[model samples]
Target: MTQHQAADTVVIGGGQAGLAAGYHLRRLGIDFVVLDAQAAPGGAWQHTWDSLHLFSPAAYSSLPGRLMPPQEGETYPDAAHVVDYLTDYEQRYALPIVRPVRVEAVHRDGTHLRVETGAGNWRARTVISATGTWWRPFLPAVPGRADFKGIQLHTVEYRSPADLAGQRVIVVGGGNSGAQIAADLAYETDLTWATLREPRYLADDIDGRALFDHATARRRALDEGRSDTGGVASLGDIVAVPPVRTARDAGLLKAQPMFTRLTATGVEWPDGTRADADAIVWCTGFRPALSHLAPLGLRGPRGHLLTTGTQAIGEPRLHLLGYGDWTGPASATLIGVGRPARDAARAIAALLGNA
Candidate 1:
């Protein structure tokens, strides 16, 4: 039951990045359509753990043309609130989004890019791929990892502390997810935090506003051809959200260096000390979900497309948005994504002579 559809521009993904690009394209009066793989709105935010919250406040973490409604008396918005906000944003603009259309490939079809999907295919003058990294969770291949008999899952599969109640758990990685999840489970269960190196724990008061300002300044420095300050904290660093702050206050934020290998029952340290655990939660990050664009032969090292302000340098018809600083400074966050999305939209419009 596959059919072929056509659009002046095709935007892949329906998350914050895709929606922002859609807003800009609509403003330009472009005949663009957004293709979302998810059955519903909210994108990857819908898939995060139940207790997860944004490190940024509502005002600072928003897409273009709209603001995320603030959580009641909370410094950070929970994951559900973000989902609701994204859903509302999609409905508010009446953006043209095709649901449940999992794009399988995007390749050359003469001058246009052919977007192959499960439901149908799209022929577009240009394509904007805003698919973020959640779907491709990265787990290092540790020795004896497969032999572990205990439960093991990445943060993507984690939902609640209830699912992991009372188990001796090892939480791995130094990012926000690892810190938050460890903090959540540390009080409920026996948990150990593991990182390759000591984590940079930003002050509990430092939130997304401070990080955004730093990101803006970094971008400004790059623009001015000046050396970066190299002092501002990165978003990747652990921010002390309430739960994490409480855990840190309780002496639970201490982390052990990563174990050398996994044991059938647990993990083994370099000194041969074995830590027994009922399960392991890998808070390791993700790679870009760009399997659809394999046919273009444009993916460079690390499977990332080199872009000049959102437009792919190797493939002129392709643009990547919201993957992170590669596309734009802080482009992965809600507030930081708008600029890259606008630049992507403008580039596509200009290419199609519709600008």
Candidate 2:
């Protein structure tokens, strides 16, 4: 027999965003279910390397109502600490989460949304898609990549530095992961970072405080269109100079040009540069995983689900929390997801009342 559960709202992806949304829905008296693919919560943080830690300070990383464990000074928490924190948050809020059940597809049937998961089927008046940015790691297609004899893997598969110990590593991409991994592997093996853009580095602190504030400020400016810049710029482009130059001088890592081809032993860079590597870790970032939703006409030309100004485009019952620019830095951070979740819960409640 097929069991079907119904709710006022259904949130997909039980990461920080989905958990936060479920918490808000419960507070608003909206019957909701959070569907997550993982056995537990914490999103990608749960799967990251053992040594991974947030770059932002604890003060900025606290979720609403619940604060991170008291840590003296401004320090980032490791991945394990974050997972434990999220687990605690779920228990405290008593948020209803359906775990280890992968959401296969979502479709709108008249006024309701139908969610099909590996566990079962669910129907809800509304849906909140809170899947975070790192759901799918983007790896650029390169010629001869399959022919490479060495192991090639995405950052998603990386678990710890021990996996690469004593091996020559090529960490691709210039983002935070690329930089951090290369730095961590410095004492373990020969490391190289490759990217098309010249690398810019930021200092660990700004004016005696963690420099994440600068990132927050820039993100705010970009989202509000208050900054003189027309489009988003990389974190390295906007940060101050001293930190940037200092990081470059550290010499723990250096940037290589873009990848051109893959050889049996390693990669070939454009400028005819080539290096032998025993392993390559692609930290190329991710895109929203909405392929299961292709049947619905929701995505934009850029492949993102087009929202009606920050909300859902055609379906008022559908909402997207933690999407960039919808609220601010909160859209990108675990702590920031609370507000959107609250709003989404309210929206769902109101819709249910009318229905």
Candidate 3:
């Protein structure tokens, strides 16, 4: 049942990044196909928790060519709205996406990159690895993690507060996800939010639009050889999204210092304080989903590819998109992804002698 397909360029992942690259590829008349592991469109957005909302308005969080249509009566769209937008974007652009084809590995085959997938294989002059970080959720290895008898889960496995209703739950990590999830569980559960350090909240007015602007300015300053202008991180750790703001105002979003270890029943701090919990939710973030590219021998000590912009330094024919700022400033966001995707597509076109 395995067959071989060929394209001048192969774009791995059909999510926002992949779709953005596809739009540019189509514009440039590049012969390429997008390979998505998902059974349908929407990509990782389909899997987010029910209560999750964007950090900005729909227009501010759009993809390459089209703006995500605003959800009715909502300033910030929820996860389901994002899914609908992504699904519609795929159809609007008519990007050639092969579904449910998980890429297992990518190997160098002579002058071409051979993308091995569950459904088939693709041979391409160039490959764009846009398979983003959602597949690789990171859970910190706290001491006694294995001994913890209570329920444990990462943000990826979390769906809705209903799943943990009435439980004494500890939500871990200081990032946006941790804050949001803790907010989601605030009313439904006995919630304890924990962070490695004190949580930093941005100005109440600051949202994804402001973050994107700051990130763009930082990138501009870097490119112009000026002193670092600073990006989103320069402001604060968490954007005061609506739910998070409400939770904070209600005194339900207070964060505790991260516990040193997990016990069979709960977690304990170095100060000899212990709190019992029915479950632990790890909002600890994720690593880049780059396991498929391991065969290329490109990752470094920290398990990240060295890149000149979006193109891999060790492998020029291979490009990475939408991981984080290293790929491109704010490249992981919907609006942020378009710039890098275009750059990647243009690079592939130039490499293939089409540009």
Best by TM-score: 3
Q: What's the number of clashes in each of the models?
A: 0, 1, 0
RMSD of 3: 1.4
What shift in Å separates residue 315 of candidate 3 from its native position after superposition? 0.9
Candidate 1 clashes between residue pairs 3 or more apart in a chain or in different chains: none
Looking at model 1, report the run of 10 residues with the lowest lDDT sum: 228-237
- Candidate 1, which segments miss by more than 4 Å at Cα? 1-3, 231-236
For model 2, the local distance difference test gives 0.72
Error of 1 at 212 (Å): 1.5
Better model by TM-score: candidate 1 vs candidate 2:
1
Clashing pairs in 3: none
Q: How much does each candidate deviate from the true structure in C-alpha RMSD?
A: 1.7, 3.5, 1.4
Kindly list the per-residue Cα lDDT of model 3 for residues 77-109, writing each as its tens digit. Answer: 998999899899889988999998899999999
lDDT of each: 0.89, 0.72, 0.93
TM-score against truth, every candidate: 0.97, 0.87, 0.98
Per-residue lDDT tens digits for candidate 1, residues 1-355, read: 5567999899999999999999999999999999999999999999999889998889889999998889997878998899999999999999999998889999898888899988878999899999999989999989999999999999999988899898999999998899999988987788999999898789878888888778878988988999976635543478888998898888988999999999889999999999998999999999999888889888787988877888888788899999988888888999999988888888878889942
Encode model 2's per-residue lDDT on 204-255: one tens digit a residue.
Answer: 3432123434445665576587863322243353232332234456776678
lDDT of 1 at 304: 89
Q: What is the lDDT of candidate 3?
A: 0.93
